[model samples]
Target: MLIQPVADLLSRNADHYLIPADIVANVQTDNNLYHAFLVLTKIKYSKIPVLDHAGHFEGLISLPLITEQMLGFDQLNVEVLMEKRVSDVMETQVKTVPNVDDVESTLHLMIDNPFVPVVDNDGLFQGIVTRREYMKSFNFLTHEIGKQYDMIEKDFSTSEKSK
Candidate 1:
């Protein structure tokens, strides 16, 4: 129940919650908007990471970003979808964290993102830490802390009665 111990608990164990890079769906920088859209649709994710040929993290692509570019005069422009690259419409200012970062940092980033992309020192895409996963872990920790606090209170009451 102590603030510092709880804070330390929250700061540890981010690595255990990661969804590894092999399972994360991503689009390449050179992929056309149409292809990126298809990937997002199939994955059912609003956004995903964009990687370069060498698998370095570049940016993030979302269905909305792709659709906005495809809209023209009240109709969808197929040409723009086919010709414009994902890089042209992707959000390059996305928040990213190194894999070594603690869950606290990851949690902070998740306030504005559904998932925080993890990268290596060289910016190679490592994986993602989703808000859903982090919240689940946090919920479990809260329950554990509550149980411990209850036991401590019981012990204190017994000692007081003995005194």
Candidate 2:
């Protein structure tokens, strides 16, 4: 695992879910639940990025936020009804693990966040690590180990049978 590439660890698993960096659905602070829902339905993610007038990460609009507001409103407007940007709702206090970290360390850090952003030494987002991915890799490793033991057992049994 020490010498293994992140790509190898990633490749052992078949499922890879990713969100595009730029295609985030967003709404102005003034938008309402109607607008939010419209955008959400179009985007692949329930978690939407919120941008300010200047086009920066302002907060995030989530299902919960829409639900909360829609519960009370018959009609909604963009300015009054729109939720904050992702910066507001996103886990701004991000916990990161280095790409070079061993699987064990990565597992430990993953205990908190389902997805941990992988970063290089310069702090650029290389990729993300998910508990599901780790579990898949672990499962593959265990399965391989089990197969080895089973082969050994079968070989011993064959030898004994001959004796």
For all predicted structures, in order, the TM-scores are: 0.84, 0.47
Local distance difference test, each candidate: 0.83, 0.53
Candidate 2: misplaced stretches above 4 Å?
Answer: 1-83, 147-163
> TM-score: which candidate is best?
1
lDDT of 1: 0.83
- Worst 10-residue lDDT window for candidate 2 reads 14-23
Q: On residues 41-152, what C-alpha lDDT tens digit does candidate 2 reach at each position?
A: 7775564555456554434566666655445357544553455433333334455555534455666777865655555565444455567767777766665655534334
Which runs of model 1 end up more than 4 angstroms from their true locations?
11-13, 149-163
Per-prediction RMSD in angstroms? 5.8, 8.2
Q: How far does residue 4 in candidate 1 sit from its true spot (Å)?
A: 2.8
